[model samples]
Target: MDESVRFDPKSPLFVNDPHGMLSILRERHPVLWGGEARALSGRVFSVWHLFSYADVGAALKDARLMREIRHVLTDEELGRAVPIPEEFQTLVNSQRNMMLFRDPPDHTRLRTLVNKAFTPRMVERLASHIQDIATDLLEPWPAGQRFDLVQEFAFPLPVIVIAELLGVPKADRDRIKSWSRIFTQVLDVEVSLETLVRGNQMTKDFRDYFRDLIAERRRNPQQDLISNLIQVTDDDGGQLSLEELLDMGILLLVAGHETTRNLIANAAWIMCRMPGLADALRRQPDLVPGAIEEVLRLEPPVMLTSRFLAEDLSIQGTAMKRGDEVSLWLAAANRDPAVFAEPDAFRPDRSPNRHLAFGQGIHYCLGAPLARQEGAIALKTLLTRYPRLTLAEADLTWTASTTFRSLTALEVETSAAPQ
Candidate 1:
């Protein structure tokens, strides 16, 4: 048996068949030692794999779990480890504008400001806009010709919606996607120098663009998220600094759209595979809310979240000192039979679904309400518009990242007439 078989980074089994592999790992060794895996950049990463429901949950909610590891690698190791170049770091730092990367008061303040922009009322209001965006994007589809649903509809719609929310320029939407794709490559364990460089440059360009956008908004304020955030004043009349503003803007642009793109693609791919479930959605549109939750449980957009232990804690009967990285596999936990009944089946009408697709406790996804709204709307629209929607081919490729799961592309045939 291949040693990497259980946790092989290169095996299709790990990539295409994570659930199955995870099942085996749980049965044999719930908390398995991954030892070290060589990165594409040739750096070795020592990871501790946690696979059970209770274990993963405890790690996520545990106060002892920290997010940053300092001095884990020796000075020599630091030299060998893939160093994010200074230029790349500078650009990446420019993007470190928002709550996703920060801790404590900063994270809390930024999240509060962002939340005000994405309130339930705000999300409901955006429904018409979302519908219009989806309609416009799909309306031009040539009926008889096959199209990649992901690239054409799933990908662009979220980008446009998020751009509108963030006050990003209409003309720069496509370029935002390009930069986002590059900047997002750091999520992979095997980070590439080229992607790091590209991601850095992308952030720099975005910062330059947003600084100008901020100045414009200050000069001539509008009704977008940027303007809303800029004008946010506390009882003491304090506002965000220039650096905070730029960071928050860049974070919203990149992380905001990236997660939803995956959610939309993953949900659609799952539905297409299960004909009955897809049919149920077509017949009962109201069931979309439940269905979205179920799909999020089965295949969450952000599959894994890691916490660097700030203090000593025990998980799955294992003791950990401060600074250990605890990875919470959301996808694995969502399907854990221990928590959810018949975890693998796609039940559209699942009741009391407590899946942690948006995570749990303090760090729950800030855009949870918005993401659900967009996903439910998109899925319902796609199914309603094309009841006969079917995959053009079944062999779709998965993106090469352990932390995130999404189809690289999914070509489909729809019932609509050729435009």
Candidate 2:
């Protein structure tokens, strides 16, 4: 296990079966510090990866670890050596403005402006529509045959839900999937130059499309999140600028689509192996929500999130310097035995589940409630539509990413007539 600590995040060993390796790392080296400079996009920085639940949870709440270092560190003080690629500037700038990448006042301001759109009441209003979309997608499937669940249902269900929520046309949802995928991929600790360049171009394309939509919403306000975002303001009359608005739209698309898609696929995959679980869910539909939580705990969508130190600090008697990057492994923490009983076991009704799937503190995912609701609805729909299911193959492959834990494709067979 000690020798396996050097394993790369994108390697086949980690992607396919990371839990077994992660459990060992958590037990042995919870605070595994890299003893060298790590380069991301040609820029170098020291990094420390936190694997234990205690360390990850505490670090997430610590204000000293800031999301946007620019808020405190000046360009001269930081002394950046490599300039960002010309093409990647749009993507970088958009990320910088997004609430996901901001700290304190900016993050608070941006999250506050859109908080109303994600409240329980708001998400509940869309429940019927989500179910309808799921039903519509499943209606065309051929019974007693093998098909790709991700391609047929899991992928498109959330896209349609979020698209309508954002007031975008259903026809246009297909175009933004690649843009969102590229955005999540480039968020890794190290990404290819080509990936960055491609992501930047897609960023520009989506920005252009969103620009027209924003303008149209301003012209004719509608009953949708986009119109609300354009017109609504905080208590202090704070409104999002054109750049901020565009970035917010991009962030919503990425957050809403990717996580929910994986959540549904992962839940279905787990159920296929659990004997009589499908009948249990159908008999007791209320178990679907609890089952979803168990899935989130066992396999989170976002693996790890990074924060930079605002000032020099020490943790667990380990000396750390200012500006050092800390990667909090949420996937590792969610599976830590110190917190969960039989952390690896798939117990659908596991109570008091305190999984940090959506993270914690100021940077907690804003779309969490919506994502959970979408997951529950999607799973229930899948269970109703397909009474019998089995994995298309035994060996499964995940996407090539360290940031996202997603299936490359989930092929499921429901070789029974649709219920």
Model 1 stretches astray by more than 4 angstroms: 1-6, 36-46, 70-84, 95-97, 142-144, 235-237, 416-419
What is the alpha-carbon lDDT of model 1 when measured against the actual structure? 0.74
Per-residue lDDT over 1-419 for candidate 2, one digit per residue giving the tens place of the 0 to 100 score: 13345746668888888888888878888877754564433445667878889999999999999988776466766666557669798888888888989887888988898895556687889989998998888888755778888888888888788889999976787787777778777777677889889889989999999999999999998888898888878898888888888999989988888888889888888877874887899889999899999889888988889899898888766777787888899999999999999898877789899899999999898888888888999899888777788898887889877877899788887866534
Candidate 1 lDDT score at position 232: 83
Score candidate 2 by TM-score against the native: 0.95
Model 1 residue-pair collision total: 7
TM-score of 1: 0.89
Least lDDT summed over 10 consecutive residues: which range in candidate 2?
A: 35-44
lDDT of 2: 0.84
Q: Which runs in model 2 stand beyond 4 Å of their true positions? A: 1-5, 38-43, 80-82, 417-419
User: Which prediction has the highest lDDT against the true structure?
Assistant: 2
lDDT per residue as tens, model 1, 145-164: 57899999888988899899
